[model samples]
Target: MRAVNSHNTPGLAGLRFAFGTLTVLPVRVSRWDRDCAGAGMRWAPLAGLAVGLCAGAAGGLLLLLGAGPLLAAVASAAVPAVLTRGLHLDGLADTADGLGSGRPAEDALRIMKQSDIGPFGVLALVFVLLAQVAALYELYGRGWGYGATAAAVAGAAARLALTLAARSGVPAARPEGLGAMVAATVPARQALGIALLVTAGFAAWGTLFGGYGAPRLALAVLAGAAAAELLLRHCVRRFGGVTGDVFGGVAETAATAALIALAVGFR
Candidate 1:
């Protein structure tokens, strides 16, 4: 579970960083410098893919065991949370509290940093989790393949948004924290390249699944990216820049948007 260090090849180091920070996996990231963070963000989709596969496998296995789609969907939704130790969800709740407060940027940031969940945070958590499970249920109803593939696509898309958000020119709201350490670390060109590659990879994944699955998946990622972009912009405007909580919020938003798009658009 030890993470690869800076001394390792760049790609391996990046993968190590991505998995180490993004998940509860045993990978131990030794380097937290900007270079490592940049590469980690670039490789974030790989971490997402791994998480998705595990989640989808859990749901798919439940379906094979004769479980109902509703139960399977709940299982699928639960895996990512368990895997990440609910870090993203917590971030989502905090970001919701911050945004819903309508306080000034400093005040809102402070609220987000608080450990307690405000009313806005609770509402946001309930609705977003509902959206995720509902969409997963629909996909599972279509068949295990649909649900599994959607899980992977949504997961990858979720991390892809993080990569995009870390591109050059994006600022961190504060001078410290994970968000600032990784902020704008990725070059714009590199981000664009990684995005295109991820999209192409997803399309390739769908080709094996048949139908218009390719476009559906590609579009799911696009939709997720677009949705994340909107949230990112709004957060930046409201909070003065991005924070770890905002990153979590964007990831969840992207994942949900991707799942919904895949559920309704392709079929």
Candidate 2:
């Protein structure tokens, strides 16, 4: 799957594909094939790193400007939504609605594809957003650095879940959509390797902060990934496979779980 562009390096092509599809960024994607998408999926955490950086920067600036932790937290929470055009959030809501519908697999999927959000979707969005903001608020109250790192780590961790999801053997629930384009594109070994590197990198960064920070952050990210994996399994069973909405749901689930873990840990 060496879907490189004639004018761009392989890495650049992958980054472009990652950012172009996963975000509302201005980067143009030169290729739309599965090879390109696979490369992009492998690079997803990098795209998330960018999103998290911007998110952290926004919240940190708000804190510098004298905004309270809660307000800064809200600003932090809004960045990912704005950056990703709320597609993931929408997917979370849809997945919630579909799951809550308690219908058969085919019917539940049909409900998920509907344009309007149901009560379950509304509730899920409200609670998830509240969880994210509250966790972020706790981190910000500790200090801007804590909040910023949490934001960045959570963002990367969230996409790490997606990288795992896209690895071999996960089938797409639908024949179409972004899930189908990227599903099973990554080798399981490659995905696991990336996961280890990401976790180790974040843990090393935490070590710079000294003491228990390293283990705390490492556990937080692993906890987040665990939560997302559970959701992925449930979605696979209930929906019969993965979908764009399932991807979104798992990503948000991972972020929220990480943030909460970071907020509550090492106290």
Candidate 3:
């Protein structure tokens, strides 16, 4: 179905409708593109919500299928890769090439658009993905319950990281592109939705594991936030701000790190 942005509803479906536009619509949505452009990045987190929940569900199913830790881990990672057609990965590659060149920002951005993959980009993608897989396997090895909790946190937190990356100070690669538009338009309130959803996920998982007794769950999430902040700081220092690729790479990396940390320390 075509995405229709409405001024009428503020319920869940209304939020979902806004999300549908960001995901399904390939070309960047603009006020020019749609009569409903004023919302800006208000809908960016909704996009994150859509992707995170879907990936989390896939992780949930992997746990349900009696899958092994390694297999389950791979499946959880694959959900976003397939769903977003590796858009974030593409960003990672491009951003790596641009940043590694050590040229002007405009030159770096130009490098990002080139069809050929540079060595820096290739190495960055491979190393990052491997790190992620290793982290997920470690989390799953802790226990199915812990693994599930990790997945839910990873799924939600990664998106929250992405939203935050978009909102933070980051010069776009171009004057008006997807990265710029999203950074410009995504509102802080919509970003809060991701935080709420993630908190609820943790709360539910905590309850399932124990009563309010699962205090470690809160700590795990706090670790995720800390990791996200660190990654953002690194990106800002290295790249001078986030690009679309940098945002995706950092999100994926932070989620992986958080899950692994949770697995290792939540004893």
Candidate 4:
């Protein structure tokens, strides 16, 4: 594995690394070492924060222009895809294909590493994207503030999964690639702290924007986190450990669950 760059400053390098790797934003990263990678993962939620803001803004603009909830929802859902160049969606598809194959672990990992999308992948992408759009539409119909908050919180919460997946006990599925490089780099305690911080932020968001009580927001976040943890365990069991695609799948799944929970609560 590549060592951390000695010259680049940690915070700025991490910020640039996070945006550069996670989104299609034109960020120039000066380092590409393991330390920088871990820092980038630690700061992944911040990248999600920016992506969420942009998505919320797009939906809010459409609403301001008198667009219907469905169109606004579509636009909001499309924003993250465009920003990330559909990387997360691709990961979701690949992961689904791998897990759905019902083959041996080696075969499944081989399938996931392939460039082509399979039938299971296509179906997974279609249904998950539809679910997101539908959930956002319901939230949007209630109020723009609630919809925007839900979008933002979901994005942040989704990216927060990366931090959890990178904790000390987690291992990489293989000896190479992004997953192997960053695997087990994050301290477990730091991951737990970050998770708590994110859950707290979600509660604040719900209270300030969704008019949700603290308990409701906490429950929603807990639900999302539980779903993510389950996905992590499944990936570890099936693939021998987490892969980069597993990280993507966990993020998308968590985000969808959180958004759905928030929509139901608001309704």
Better of 2 and 4 by TM-score: 2
Task: Score candidate 3 by lDDT.
Answer: 0.61
If scored against the real structure, what TM-score would every candidate get?
Answer: 0.96, 0.96, 0.73, 0.94
Ranking by TM-score: 2, 1, 4, 3
RMSD of each: 2.8, 2.2, 4.9, 3.2
* Model 2 stretches with alpha carbons more than 4 Å out: 1-10
Superposed model 3: Cα runs more than 4 Å off: 1-18, 21-66, 168-173, 186-204, 211-215, 233-241
TM-score of 3: 0.73
**Could you tell which candidate, 2 or 4, scores higher by lDDT?**
2
C-alpha local distance difference test of each model: 0.91, 0.91, 0.61, 0.85
Provide the lowest-lDDT 10-residue window in model 2: 4-13
- Residue 52, model 2, lDDT: 88
* Cα deviation of 158, candidate 2, in Å: 0.9
Regions more than 4 Å wrong, model 1 = 1-7
TM-score of 1: 0.96
Cα lDDT of model 1 by residue, 1-267, tens digit: 988545566777778899999999999786678888999999998999899999999999998999999999998899999988898899999999999999999999999999999999899899988998999999999989889988898889899989999999999999999999989999999988988999999999889878887988899999999999999999999999999999999999999999999879756
Tens digit of per-residue lDDT, candidate 3, span 1-267: 977654433443334444544354443332332113324333444465456566556656777788777887777677767766777677777777877899776677678778887988899789867766676677677676565566666655665666656553445545455555445344456555655666565765676776442556655555666676686676566655556666666666666666666666654
Model 3: worst 10 consecutive residues (lDDT sum): 29-38
User: Per-residue lDDT tens digits of candidate 4, residues 67-110?
Assistant: 98899899889999899899889989999999999998999999
Q: How accurate is candidate 1 locally (lDDT)?
A: 0.91
Record all residue pairs in model 1 with backbone atoms less than 3 Å apart, i.e. clashing: none
